[model samples]
Target: MTETPLAPPSARRSRSRGRSQSPRSNEPGQNLHLRVPYITRNIPTYDLLSEEALDRIEATAERILAEIGIEVRDDPEAVRLYREAGASVSDVSANAWRVKFEPGMVREILKTAPAEFTQCARNSANNVVIGGKASVFAPSYGSPFIMDIDGTRRYGTIADFENLVKLGQSSPWLHHSGGTICEPTDVPVNKRHLDMVYAHMRYSDRGFLGSITAPERAADSIEMCRILFGSGFVDNNCVIMGNFNTTSPLVLDGVTTQGIRTYAEAGQASIHLPFLLGGAVSPLTMAGSVAQCLAESMSSCALTQLVRPGAPTVLAGFLSSMSLRTGSPTFGTPEPALGSLVMGQLARRLQLPLRCAGNFSTSKMPDGQAMQQSMMSMMSAIQGGANYILHSAGFLDGLLSMSYEKFVMDTDMCGALHAYMKGMEVDEDALGFDALAQFGPGEHLFSTDHTLRHYETAYWDSALNDDQPWETWSEQGGIDAAQRANTRWKKILAEYEAPHMDEGIDEALKDYIARKKASMPDAWY
Candidate 1:
C-alpha cells in the first residue's frame, strides 16, 4: 500500500525508487491524471426487478443452498475447507462432494468481502477502483479462434496474442487488458500463462486478469505479478484479478476452487461467477436460472472470505440463453440481458460490485447481427451498474472467436456509452445561455467561444466510425467498418511503442518464464 503512485504514460520515472507513484503528464495540454478510459455512474442504476421479485429470488437462492445443496467436485482440499468453513460436506460421491450450507453461512461470510477495492496497474494512472459507481471495460477472454484482418479464421498463435495485447494497450477505451484475449494455441497449454502475463506487463501498463486454468498457473501468474510490480506492492495491493467461474448446475469444480483460494489468499481480486447456458446448464426460465446463478456465485464468493477475509470479489453474471431450435448457446438474447439487469440489482442489494458478459454476439463475422447483439449486451451492463465488464470486446460466435474488427468497434461503443454515462452537465455554463443570446437565430455556433472550448470533449469521436460526405467517402474507397478496423490495427501495430519497463525487470521476467518452460514438459491441450 505504501508503493509510490504511478507516473502518467508521458512521465518517465525511476522504477528503483517505486513503481506506484503518479506524476503529471509532460504533455502541455493533456492531463496526465486522465490516463485510461473509466466510467463513474452518475445516474440511477436500472433495476429490472420489483422489490417483491428481488426478495423472492434471494429467498429462493438461500433455499437452494440449504435444501437442494451444491456439489463441490474433485478437490478434497476444498471439500475439507468447506467443512471447516461450516458447510455440511457429505460422502455421497468421491469425485462429487455434496455441500449444503447452514441457514446463515453464506450471508454471514459475505460480510467479510469488500464492496470496492483498488485494482492497481503498472502505470498508477491506469489503476482502477472497481465497485461502487465505477465500471471498467476489459477485452474478451478464452477464445481459441481468431478472425484476422484479412478475414481468415485460424487458430490463435503467440503472435496473435501479442497483437491483441498491443491493440488492447493502445485502445483509448479498453481500461483493462483481458486475460486470454485469444487463446494462444501455438504455445503449450502449461506455459502460455507466462507468455500472456509477460505480454500484459510488457505491452500495457494497464490492469489485467490472472490465470485460472489451474492452480499452478494461477500461482505462476501471482508470482510473475510480484516480480513485475514489486513484492511489497503485489501483497499489499490488488495487481491482478482472477475470474473464478462456477461450474453450472451448482457445482464448484476443483480448478475453480483452487483459482479462488490462491488468488484470495494472495490478496488479489476475483470475479466470482457461474457460466450458465440455459436448458443445458440450468432451467430455461429466467427466475430458475437467476436463482441457481446467485446461489452458485454467492456461495463461492463467501468461500473467498473464508480463505482470506476482506478479499475483493465481484458478483458476476455470464448466463447465456440457448438457441432452442439449434440447442446451441446464444448471446445478446432477451433472456440473458434481462437476467443480467436483475443480477445487477441483486448485487446492489448485497452492496457488492457486479461483473457480467459484455460486447457479446452469436455472429461469426462483424456484421449487422454482431453490432446489434453486442450493443444490446453492453447497454445492459451500463444500465445495470455493472462494475467490471468482462469479455467486453472482440467476442463472437458464442465466445468461440475473437474478432479484430469487433474489438475496435466495441471500444468505440464503450467510449460513446461512457460519455452517455457521464450524463449532461445541467449547469448554467452548459446551458449556453450567452451563446444562445449572442448567436440569436440562424447564427453559427462553430466559431463561438463556448463551442470551441467544449467541442473537443463534449462528444465522443470514433477512430473507426466514419462520418464523411459521399464524395469524400467514395474517394476513400468505400470500405466498411471492419475493413477500416483492419487498416487501423495494422497501423497501430506498426507504430506501437510499448509502455516503459526497466531492463532488469524485463530480463527477470524473461528468466522466470524461461525457467518455468524448461521445468515443465509441453502438454498441448
Candidate 2:
C-alpha cells in the first residue's frame, strides 16, 4: 500500500474558511456540562464472536437445557406453565420439579417480549428508554456494608441508603436512581424494601428498580409505583423494574420464578441475571460459562413471557472468575469481559435488550486497584452494548460494601464515558480548515475563531483529577484522588436538594409504609 503525502502548511493556510463562527452568549462553566437522561451510542458495538460461533453457542445452550434440565423448585405454577408450553416436567420432590425444553421452545416463547420499551419517571422529562441504542447508568444495588468517608468500614443503615439515593440524584451523570443502593441493616428485613422504594421516589424523579426478595415485596413495590404515578399509568407503561438472580447450576427457585411472574403479570420489566462464577458454579472455560449463562437466563426470561406476552424483559449475564486455590470469587477480569462481549451478541440474536458488566472490583478501598479493575469491567459493558447498567457506582468490597468516595470517583468516570460514547463529529467546521486559514506556520491557533466556538464543549473535564504542578499539589497537602473524592461527595451531600413530590402522595406513601411495618414483626437474619 502506498502512503498519502500530507499537504504543505502554506497550502493549508490558503484554504477558505467554510463558515463564520459565533460565540455562545452564556458559556458553560467547567463543571457545568450537559446531563443526558440516558446515553444513545453513536459508535458501533464491539462484536467479539462471528455468526457461526454465535450459532454454536446458542446450540450448546439448547443442548444444555434439553439434556441437563433446570430444577423449578417449589413453583408449581411455573412448572405447569412449562409443561403446557411443550416442556417436559417431572416431579423431583414434593415441591420441586425438573423442567426440560426442546431446542427452540424458549426462544419462541421469548419472541412475545418487546425488543425495547420505555421506563417512565415521576418527572416525565426524566423518563428513559431501556433498549436498542440506549444505555442508562444506575447506582449499585444490595450492598450490606459501607466504607464511610471517615475511613471506617461498617454495616449500612437506612440513613446510609437514603444518603446514597441523595448522592445519585445530585449526580448529573447517573440517569436511574437504582434499587437497594445498600441494605439498611438497622431496619427489619421484611420492611426495608418499603423504605428503600420510598426513598427512591422521594429523593429522585428518575426511574429505578424495585425489590425482588419476595413476591409480596415485588407487589408492594409495584403498588408504591402506582401511588406515585397514577394507577392507570402504572398498569399501561413500565415505571419500575426488578433485578432477579437465578440460582446457578441451572436451578430456578420458586421465590425467584414467582417474583418474575409478579413483575411480568403486572406489566412491569424484569432483568433475568445469572451470576456465574468460573470453576465453581460453572465451567472454568469462558465459552462453556457463556452457554450456561445463556441457558439459565433464557429459562427465566421465557417465564416472563409465559405470564404476560409483550412484557419488557432484559437478558443479563454476570460472569466472574475465581481464585482456584482459595475458591473465592473474582471480578473485573479479562475472561469475563470477553464473556460479556459475547453475551451482547447473543442478546441481539434473541432480540432482547442486554444488561451486562459494570464498575466491578474486589478491592476494599477506592484506590488504584479499584479504579483499574473498574475500567476493565466498565469498558466491556460500554463496548459490548449493554443497555441498562446496574452497579454503575458505589461498588466496593466485591459488592459487599458501598464506598462514598468510590461513588463520586465512578460518577466522574461515567461523565467521561458520556463524551467517549458520543464518538467524533466530522463536518465542515470540525475539519479545522478555517483555523489553518486564520493562522500560518509557527503561529499558535489558540486564539482562532474556531477554537472559541467549540472550546467550552470540546473536551470532558474531570472533577476529581489533579493536573497541577507537583509543587502546587504538595502545597495543597498532597491530596490524592481518593481524598479529593471524599471531599467532593461530602460537598455534594451538604448541598443536596430533593426533587419535588406532592404532599398527598408523600403522606400516602408514609401511611402505607407504617401500616406494612406494623403488620410484620422484626426479623433479622
Candidate 3:
C-alpha cells in the first residue's frame, strides 16, 4: 500500500499565508464535537410488544418469504449462492429462492461490532472519522443517474462513477464517496464492480460504501480496498455491507445476509437502509409509513448489534412516495421529507448516527422547482439533525437522473447548510464589544478595523448566488444559478489537483484488477 505523502513545512506555510484573514478562533468549529455513543435504543414501552406480539411479526415475515419469496433475475451467481446457503429453491427454475432466515440468526450476525469507523481522504488533511461523532459524513453523489455536460439533461452511464469520485474529493461538506455511481452497464456486470472500485481509488482516496450487487463482487470490492489501504486499515472506516434492502415485513434475503456476514467477519461497519415507497408498498399516511420504516430500521439495527455488539452501524431510512394511479416513483413529496425529519429525531433518540437524504431535487433540470424541492428537503434533514446525509447532490426524478448544474448548485447549498449548522456564535469578540465601543449608536462599523478584519469570516460566501440589482446583474452575464454553478464546476475541475500516489502504485492497482478479472470465469462477466 502507498502511504500518502506529507506536505513540507514551507508548503504548509504558503497554504496558510492568506488563511489568517479568517483565523481559527476559539470557536465551536475548532473546539466543539458532537458524539453519538450507541446505535440502539431501549424499545419504547409503548412501541414494545409482548413476546407473543413480537413472535407474530417474525412469523409473518417468515410466512411471506416461504410463500412469496424475492425476485432475483439479475444474477445467476446470487441464485446459486442462495441455494447453497440452504434457501428453498423453485422447481424447474434455477434463479428463484424462498429464504427463511431465523431471527436469532439475524441477531447473531450483528453482535460485538465496533461503534465507529474512519475514512481516509485523498489528502490526509480531509480524512473523516465517522460512526463515533453525532453525525457521519458521506458525499453528495451516488444515486443511479448521469448528468450531461451541457447542464441541461441527464442519462445513466458508467462515467458517472469517475465524475462522482472527483466531486466527492472536492466537497468539504461530503466525507465519503459512496459506491454505485450509476450502473456500469457498458462494461460486463462482474467487471463493472472492479472498474468502479478502481475509479474511486484512482480519482479519490476516500472511504467508500459497498454495494449489494453480488456476494462475489462485494467481497472483491473489500479486497481491492484492503490492497490499496492495507487490510484492517480500510476496514476501520469503510462500510462493507451498505443499503441491505429488506424484503419488506423485515425479512433478510439469503444473498443480502451473506454480504453482511462477509463484512462482519472482516470487521467492517454495516448500514441497513429500509427503502420504503409510501402510498404503494407502504401506507399512504405519513405517520403510518414512518412507523413501519422506523420499525424495520430498528429491527435491522438491533440484529446488527446482537450479532456484534457495537458493530459500527447506521440507521438509514429512505421513505419516498409512490404514485398511486401510475405506480411510478415520485420525488419531492412531503411524505419522504416529513418522514426523514422524524427519522433523524428518532435516530437521535436511539443515540445512533442516522443516514438520510438531503438537498435532493426531483426536477430533471436546474430550475426553480429543483431549487425549491432541494432546499426544502435538505433543510428538513439538517434542522432535524440527521447524522449523515447521503445522495445529497446530482439527483433528480426520484434519484434516477443527475445534472451537472444541479450538482454544483447542491454543493453551494451544502456549504450554506454547513454554515447554518454551525449556528450562532456568542462570545465577547462576536458580540463586537470593542467595536461597539469604538463606534457608538448609529455609527458605521463597515469601515472599522474589527469589521474589516472579520466580515468574511462572519458569514458564508456563495459562488452561485448573488443578490445584486437587475441593472448590475444584466451588466454581467445575467445568468441563472445553474449557469453560474456550471462555470464554477469547470473552474474547480481545472484547478484542483489530488495529492500524488507513490511510484508504481497506480500500475500495481491496474495490474491487480486485471489479474482478478482473469481469475474469474468468462461467463461471470
Candidate 4:
C-alpha cells in the first residue's frame, strides 16, 4: 500500500484559544518512537461469495429497508431528519418511528462518506490512516469484568482501567488505546467519561475512542479533547472516533443517535456498528444476517451524512451467533466469520472504512479455547480486508470479561498476523540468489554476512509461546502461558513511562475534570 500525503501546513497550527499555548508530547518539534506498525493490504482477500450471491444479498437489504422498514427510537429530530431526507417515517407506536428508505437512498447518502481519512494522534508519529489499504488494530473494549493469573475474576475499578491503558501504551503491536478497556464500576455512570478520557490523556498519546453511553457524555468527550488538542485542531481534524452500536432487529435508540450527531457535526469519525446475534436477534443464515447488517449499518451511517455531509463514518459488522441448545452467545463461529468477509466487501462497495471484531471469544480461561476463538475471529477479519479492528486482545467470556494474560497472548498473535500480512519482499536484495550460490550444496551459510544482516527481522518470535526441549522446560519450572504472560504484563506496567506533556496543560485538564464531575448529578442507571 502507498502512503497518504501529509496534511497541509495550515492544519498544523499551534493551540490558539484565548489562553496561551500548552505543552504537548507532539508539540511541533518533539519526536517519540512509540509508534506501532499498522497492517497494510499486501495479500489477496478471501472471497466466500459469488458475484451473484453478493448482489442477491445487497438487493435483499434494500428490499428490507424499503418494505418492512426499521425503527428509530425516541428521537423525533432524527425522524424529522429522515423525513426531510425523503424517507417515509411513521410514528404509529409509542417510542417508535418506522423509517422506510426510498430505493437507492442508502447508496446516495453513502456517496458523501469518505473512502479514506486520518485519525490524528497526539504524537504525529502515531497517526492512523483508516480505510484505503490500512488495517489498524485496537485493544479489547467494553468488557465489564477483569481476570488475573490466580483465577481471580471480579469487577474492574479505576485503577484497573488506568493500568490497561498503560499496557496498551507499552505494547508495540497495539495501534489504539481502545474504549472501555474494562468498565470502572466504582465510578458513577454519569461522570465516568471524564475519568476515562483523563486516563487516556495522561497515560496514552495515541488517538482514542470517544464516549457513546450518552449524548451529553459525547459532548463532554469533545470538550476534554478540545483542551488536549486545542479547540481549532479538534474541530478541523478527526482526533477521536466514537463507536455507536445500534440495537439489533431494526432499532436506533436516542442515546446512540445523539452521540452520532455530536461527533458527526464536529467532523469526527464514528463507527456505525450493529451487534447481531444470528438466529436470535437476526436471521440464522449468513446471507440473511449480512443483509440485516447492511440495512442497520448503512441506515445509521446515512443518518450521519444527513447530520453533516462528508462526516467520516465506518461500516461495522459485529455479527455473531448463539448456541442452539443453551442459547448462549458463541464467538469465533463460522457464521460470524462469513459475516466479516461479506462486511468487508460491502464496506468497499459503499466507499467507506470498515470495522470488524478481533480476538473475540467465549472462553473464561486463557487456554486452547481462548486461543482458537481469537485466531478464528482475527484471521477472518484480516483476510476479509477490515480497515479497523476493535477488541484485538483480551476479550473473554463472550466479551463480558477482559483477561490480562489473554491480552498479552493475543498481542503476540496479532504481531505474527501483521508480519504475515506484510507479505514477502522479492527484490534483488531480498532474493539473495548470489548468497545462496556462494553457499553451494550441503554447505552451511550460518557465518555469512547475509545471515547476520537478516537475523534481527527474518523470522517471527513469540514472547510467551514455548518451543524448547523437555529438559529445558523443566529447568524453567514448566510455567504455563498465562503465568508467563502475567509476569510480562507486570514488567510492562512497571517500566511504562507516560509520554511527556506540558505542566500547564496537565493542571488545566485536572481542573476541567474536577469541575465537570461536580457539575453532573451522580447517575447509576
Return the top candidate by TM-score.
Answer: 2
- Candidates 2 and 3: which is better by TM-score? 2
Predicted candidate 3 versus true structure: per-residue lDDT over 1-525, tens digit per residue: 113334322224334543211111112352122111111111121222344644554454344444554444334444555455454555334544343444343233334443444445433454445443334345554455566548434445567667666765665555556767566556676677788877766666555667566777778877866666555455454424355666564445557666655565565666777777776666777666666665555555544454345566767777778778898776666667877776665654455666776766667777889888877777666655665567677676667766667777776666665555555668878888878778788998888878987865677666568789999999997887777777776766665555345435567778878998898764434
**TM per model?**
0.93, 0.94, 0.77, 0.93
Candidate 3 matches the true fold with a TM-score of 0.77
Shift in Å, residue 242, candidate 3: 3.0
| Candidate 1: residue 7 Cα off by (Å) | 8.1
Worst 10 residues of 4 by lDDT: 19-28
Superposed on all Cα atoms, the candidates' RMSDs to the truth, in angstroms, are 3.3, 10.0, 7.5, 4.6
At residue 444, candidate 2 shows an lDDT of 89
lDDT of 2 at 360: 97
Residue 257 shift from truth in candidate 4, angstroms: 0.8
lDDT of each: 0.83, 0.87, 0.59, 0.83
lDDT digits (tens) for residues 1-525 of candidate 2: 011122222112222222211111111375344457789999889999999999999999999999999999988999989999999988899999999999999999999888888887776556788888989999998898989558689899999999999888877788899999999999988889999999998888778999999999999999998877767767778889999999999999989999999999999999999999998899989999999999999999999989898999999999999989899888888999999999999998998999999999999989999999999999999999999999999898899999999999998899889999988999999898998889878888899999999887889888789999999999999999999988888888887766656677789899999999999899886
lDDT of 2 at 11: 17
Candidate 1 positional error at 14, Å: 5.4
Worst 10 residues of 3 by lDDT: 36-45
Q: Residue 204 in model 1: shift from native, Å?
A: 0.9
Expressed as tens digits, the lDDT of each residue in 49-163 for candidate 1 is 8999999999999999999888887788878877898888777676888999877789888987888888888776677878888889899999989995685898999998999
Q: How accurate is candidate 4 locally (lDDT)?
A: 0.83
Badly placed stretches (over 4 Å) of model 1 are: 1-37
